[model samples]
Target chain A: MFFKFKNKKITNMISIVPNNIIKFEDEAGQYNFPIKRTLKMMDIMGYKEHRLFNDSVILSDVAVYGLNYMFENNIINKEDIDALLFVSNCTDHIIPPTSNIIQGKLGLKTDMICLDIMQACAGFVVGLLQSFMLLDSGSVNKVVLINGGTMKSRVSKKDRNSWPLIGESCSITVIENGGNNDVFASVYMDGVNSNALIIPAGGFRMPSSEETGKLQTLEDGNERALDHLTMEGVGVFNFVQTVVPEELKKLMDYAKIYDKDIFAYLFHQPNKFMLEKLADKMGMERSKMPSNVVENFGNSDSGTIPLVTTYNYGSLFEQEEKTVCFSGFGAGLTCASIIMNFGKLENCKLIEYGKNR
Target chain B: MREKILEILQDLRPELDFTESNDFIEDGYLDSFDMVALVSNLDKTFCISILGEDIIPENFANLEAIENIVKKYK
Candidate 1:
């Protein structure tokens, strides 16, 4: 199962594997509560803090820390990186793309290929797949894939169910072609559920405008403007509860692996309760499930899955563990998972990126 | 005033020991978000508005620095 690009040779291509994974969050940064507080503080400073989810300082902090940590550990040199793939719907600014900003900040070569993928929750996996394809095509040797987002403060405070739940995070994974025997990946999306969770304003379909801002309320009393994140909680829950498990089972079967063979199930950290419910439905032991960092960090959009992976790498990659599953589903009504067989954990270093800038 | 700020720091982030002159950001005690929240609480508690520019790293470096800002504004 290989994808070939026209006019591109696949031979002598390097295999992209997860060499090092790093997850970062601000030391004392809490989720929506702190975001709300920050907004209120901004209000006090006379800057109307509208579009709460537009730019996430916390997520950026985590990302910068992770990148710096990788640099510090010498996993991938700034000069050695051939391209950067940043997957996130939440960006630091509206223009110039977040990839450029990250490239500049990380002191990577200016000529390095920089691109941003605005996929919602399934971003990190999408990033991984994209980087893998790039590696397989011989287009790039070493690529840094960063998946993160700040969706906590984006949810409308008016919506009680989602307001207190969203978490923010940023994580980075360095994938270089290697000697591991990890199972390949598959990704799928449900366009029908796209509207189930979205920021109604601030995009090509519906650009931000005063008129659109006025039509802010949905039938469920959720805001439809860019001011906050709007989610149909029950709708999203039903979708995830139904789609994710089915997809995971399908992927596992396709890979000729059984549920019991899966060493650990790393899914998106939406919330503690929801994840446990999904784990229960899949007939997997709660102990096999990874810890939900969202309790403190909130739902960090694309960063959730990688953050979970980074946090649980120790237990999953024990002495000679061979198989683990990574899954993430969110915004785009998207779900993605891949079974990876980590051959040896001794060679890889788990870098702890601290937040400095 | 310094002791009061220390009390608040200890309350917010119990992980750190709030000494009289601890550099919050440098020592890994607090972050940008924490600093923002701390300033908000300080303003409400002491009835003062902290300017955005005033919320720089130097001003929020320690208990003494926070107390000075609060007292000056108060």
Candidate 2:
């Protein structure tokens, strides 16, 4: 589906990553491949270091800390937010919505709508889509979209295919009902290929079991339990290179904006190789698309795009308005894109959360 | 068609000699990422859309396998 929204703008964004970091080179000995081969693979796959919290820390814990940071810095007022949207694969609990928990933890107003959106990499754009719709209703003036996941808690360290690339971080974005430009957005979902990226067990359909928890060496030589996150890497890579560029082109054509007009292509960073391939396929200038998020912070699920923007542009987003493309694709088997004159933010920060709290 | 397929493979990973190895995947000449890229290049070059189900490793194992895939789609 395609959408056009007027006057809904993302005014502030803050991406908070864990303080504890793990470098790929240091952990090369753990995988099935030889250390030398693994190190070579690391360079090929663009695995550098990833940020993850201790097992004790949950998504809400880091989200609370992030919200507190914004509150402390006066970047966002707690009372001003009319809606809270938490987009993540890692919710605090399956029953009580994490957004409501965050609201209660922060002591925010009860009257506001608090909802949890279950999504992965394509979440930021999906969250933005929801926020824009909320703002369009006129009842809501401000929406706080919290996107990220403690994905390391799910991916097994023994699974070399996914472990090194998974990073944990939370991004808090404030969207409001005041902008002068039109925003173009589109979403494409293929539930048929949902298995491309998934946790095979631990859900209601396939509840957690002792059998499911038992780690076994798979055909590919990676050891993983059914509960561990698995990826059909080629399927995902093919989906991105084929589907994403097509959808992005359609969005750009609809928006009537060319590559020259785009200030940046803030895509959800799967890794350096994939992003470069996507950029090459789209005929986009590689410089415009920032692919360093994976190497720096790993792929923070839904938060990666916001992490890309804040990590790359920083305060520049607050100083000037620029035409930018924001894309997030993966697990939901979802690909989404949003284009707008994005800038004039009160805060655009990338901070380490665990160091303090 | 074979020349086009080889050209696509060569363009995707210029370091690897596509003709030298019968099993590009097993020989480590092409990994999963390369397979996807190769599929994409073939799809674009031949103006044929290869469905996701047909993107298995065996279909992209070697030059003959890839050529067969392109022939089916074309």
Candidate 3:
């Protein structure tokens, strides 16, 4: 006997208006290497007309900025948001939960449902899937999904590998109930090589403490407890090489679509090298692989994929009938892939708020 | 100096057919990060600290512009 999951129609599909994105440049006008400068950059970027701000180095700034941006654009009223989804690897406040902080900052409804998802890089994808499910369930009409990261704060400043490979960013995508067939399909990773990448400290198994803090080293030295990110590069490469292709194949199989059907493939902007390698392995063109933001933002944890989509929105979705594939992979050693179709909208307009001169 | 700048830019973006006349940023050949990194590497190679104000888009717009700036300091 075979069990089949019924395909539900997503009406009035969730799509971003004013898809052209404005980047939050660092105050010192530098790249990702300088963490202090980068944090300051967020504050400067926030002060601009854009809706988001980076008040503190904490990850919640992403949600705060998103809410602020939405309000500024008159996209949604504070009381109108029905559900809140906060996706991040770093949440400064442990007790009340990060989503609560976001709700407090945004002055959202007290009755609003809030939850925090700690899925590292794949957090955005998980949040997207969860928001879709919630919207499809008819329980919530509008959901705010925030994807933010501050991996730089967690890494030792002197650690070259982590220092160069990690960066910070936050973005929010608001999903609303619109009956449309545009949302399309999704695929997730099955349990295999779950521990390919991780942070060895500050979790339930190895809780953060003074002693653990002292033992942490920012370099590739003997001290393992500096609360830094750890990854088996080769191990992750192997798993990504194996599972991502399988996930892509499965998504294609389930959607009954071919490689040429999709307009663009927006995978997590891992790095230039990894992206090129993955493109080669997946039998996809380098152009189809939309981005590798490592040069500017480094690996922005969960924010990378969305950032790419936001940046490349014009070129990727120029055609009326277009399909874009979004895939994210990171710490749970998790991966989530979704294929979305885009259609012309009459109400959507691009907003350019920043100063060119 | 022009040839050297061209060499550095070529190294940064091996895909781009860069010349002394090509505008790095406006031509979509180099981004903000690439410009910063290029300045840092150039400063190291020539042993000069480039002020933030001096590193404008116009100066690094092409190989000739970068060479002119470098020659002024040298």
Candidate of highest lDDT: 2
Docking class for model 2 is incorrect
How would the docking of model 3 be graded? incorrect
Question: lDDT for each of the candidates?
Answer: 0.62, 0.86, 0.60
Could you give candidate 1's per-residue lDDT for residues A236-346 as a string of tens digits? 666667778888888877777887787787777766545655776687787788645554344667776766655556443444555777777877888888776643433
- Tell me each candidate's i-RMS in Å: 17.9, 6.7, 15.5
Off by over 4 Å in 2: A355-357, B1-21, B24-60, B63-74
Range of the 10 consecutive residues with the lowest summed lDDT in candidate 2 chain B: B31-40
Chain B only, TM-score of each candidate: 0.88, 0.94, 0.88
What's the TM for model 1? 0.64
lDDT of 1 by residue, B1-74 (tens): 76667777776776667773367777767755466558767876887766443556788888778888898878
- When sorted by lDDT, best at the front, the candidate numbers are 2, 1, 3
Off by over 4 Å in 3: A1-55, A182-192, A215-226, A314-321, A343-357, B1-74
| Candidate that beats the other on DockQ, 1 or 2, i.e. the better one | 2
Q: Write the per-residue lDDT of candidate 3 for residues A118-149, one digit (tens) a residue.
A: 77777777787878777767678778777757
